[model samples]
Target: MIAFLKKRAKMSFLLLLKVLRFYWLLLNVWHFSRTKISYEAVKWRNISIYFHFKSKIIKYLTSNILSKINISLNSSNKNFSSYIK
Candidate 1:
């Protein structure tokens, strides 16, 4: 009976150790996944901001060019009309 009890105790101890190791592995996996997700979020946000700023710059430049063209056309029309008169 004593030998049987000793064997059972050892088995229980080994089971407990295996459970602890499994939990440790699960915790590490959870931590790594969370970190990876946060890193990707930040990286995508920066890329979106960069594209937004680039679009704004292009819009501003095009608008300026259009206004300048309108001004030059109006001036030329006035000069031509005056010359004809």
Candidate 2:
């Protein structure tokens, strides 16, 4: 009976650990979802400002990398420009 009780105690501990792990994951997911929703709820002007800065950084990085690689941004093809417009 003591052995059975010990086994039951071990099982209960494992179950408690599993429940704690599940709650931890649930909390993390809830936090991320809340963050995402709050970010999305931001004003369009603020979001655009964020994106504008992001694009500038990206453009700077790409331009520097491409220049290092000797790749020209200005293509001689007029057809490509027309197609883009």
Record all residue pairs in model 1 with backbone atoms less than 3 Å apart, i.e. clashing.
none
In model 2, which regions exceed 4 Å deviation?
A: 37-85
Candidate 1 per-residue lDDT over residues 1-85, each given as its tens digit: 9999999999999999999979865865676587775656655765897799999999999999999999999999999999999
RMSD (Cα, Å) for all candidates, in order, is 27.0, 18.5
TM value for model 2: 0.41
Best-fitting candidate, scored by lDDT: 1
- Cα lDDT, all candidates: 0.85, 0.76
Error of 1 at 66 (Å): 0.8
User: Model 1, stretches more than 4 Å misplaced?
Assistant: 1-37
Worst 10 residues of 1 by lDDT: 37-46
Candidate 2's residue-wise lDDT over 4-75, tens digit each? 999999999999999997996586567668877554544454568779999999999998998866644355
Question: How far in Å is the alpha carbon of 77 misplaced in model 2?
Answer: 93
Error of 1 at 85 (Å): 1.4
